[model samples]
Target chain A: MTLLVTVFAAIICTILWYKRKNDEMRLGTLCFLFWGASLMWLGDAIFEYAELHEEFFTPAPADMLNDLYLGLSVVALAMILWLIILLIKDPKGAVRRALQKK
Target chain B: MACFLVGAAEAIVVTVASKAIKASESKKELAVRSKGGEKAVDALREKQGIPWSRKLMWLAYLLWGGAFLLAYEHVWHGEVVPWFPFLTAMNDPGDTAEMLHEMSTVGVTMAVIVTVVWALLCVAADLILKRRANSPLENA
Candidate 1:
């Protein structure tokens, strides 16, 4: 699930980046982030499959649900991290203005 | 989760590099300041570093919140075991295997579902973008 989610994010980011051809949003950074995440998950899946062999074909539902949670959590964390970067950069100075308005 | 973390780390690297490049360019670069004491630049950022598809940002954020909340509820309720190998057949510490084979079918199923949903989201967004571009107001 994590792999799939990252793959999806990577694809979406890439498309948006390409369409806009603009880096002000740091879409390139975002696109690379998701893509790297997807690859990592893919590697983990492969390693687990290699270790488990045939047993990997069947997994308990509870465990699957756990993976789903972990995947979603990772995505959330990624967004949070990106948001931090955005706030620091403050491209439009909106935050600075709001803060200065006593 | 580990994979995602690693990806985020990689992204940070690229981001910092991009910033460094911009900072190096003393000439061709201008950092304007507003009355609010904020530095402004001529870049691709629409506002506050948001992408062109502002809706997409909010949508992704809302969905992520929902998923995170729901997942947390399930984890808290013990509906899903919080094991290290949640995706592997080794989910249960008690369960042991002689030889490894293929990835878990259940895991594959979950991955597929996530990918499908994501594809749908992107396709919908793309369609909306295209339509908006064609709208008379945009052309006018």
Candidate 2:
């Protein structure tokens, strides 16, 4: 159930991000953070589910997943910071320059 | 927890320092542009005055850093390791060291991928915006 919710949230966030394509950096950073957090939540949910089903001893990959999850969170946070800096330096100007390069 | 807290502190300090440097540069640029009789709007480019949103973003970074460390030391080391009862996992005699190494690798890899993707997206978004701004119809 928790996994379902996480996946659903991820999907909704992704759709919203695409809909706001023009403001991709801002929306993308937000979505990335959501995704990272959801992934971590999913890892925990899986562990709990396994425990409930009496399959708890089944060499869970929780550590690996947690590491990956936290790593992704940090990355997302960094991206958010970068976007903020860009926005502060010159919100419109930065975006304009970036678009010009593309 | 300690490691995570330390990491968070470091991230905050670094972010503030960088912002200060940028602010100084912005001030200099403002002075130069003003001396050249640039438009008043040019003064808005001063980096010294960062928006509240950007400051919040920096805080987010620090929180995330601390969370990563906490997750690594507490959840990863405590819950995850014991759960993964595989011989491969046991290959590392020093459990803490192994976990830390793995976490570091994951962190670095994610950071690199996110950075690259962000750069690409920023470039793409900028191009689209510029085209729209430059259109004759829009100007009219």
Cα deviation in Å at residue A31, candidate 1? 1.9
- Candidate 2 residue-wise lDDT, B32-54, digit = tens: 77776565435554332444335
Residue pairs in clash, model 2: A98-B126, A98-B127, A99-B126, A99-B127, A100-B127
Q: Indicate the docking level reached by candidate 1.
A: incorrect
Q: CA lDDT of A66 in candidate 2?
A: 59
Stretches off by above 4 angstroms in model 1 are: B1-140
Best-performing candidate as measured by lDDT:
1
* A10: Cα error in model 2, Å: 4.9
Per-model TM-score versus the true fold: 0.43, 0.43
lDDT of 1 by residue, B1-140 (tens): 11222223333443455455545443223333332223344342313232323433333332333334333434544543567644333554433231122224423333343334445666787677677768999889
**What is the DockQ score of candidate 2, to 2 decimals?**
0.06
Residue-wise lDDT of candidate 1 within A1-102, one digit each (tens)?
Answer: 656676787788778988985466766546545554464456556767878998776778887777677767767776776777777887768789999998
**Scored by CA lDDT, what does every candidate get?**
0.51, 0.49
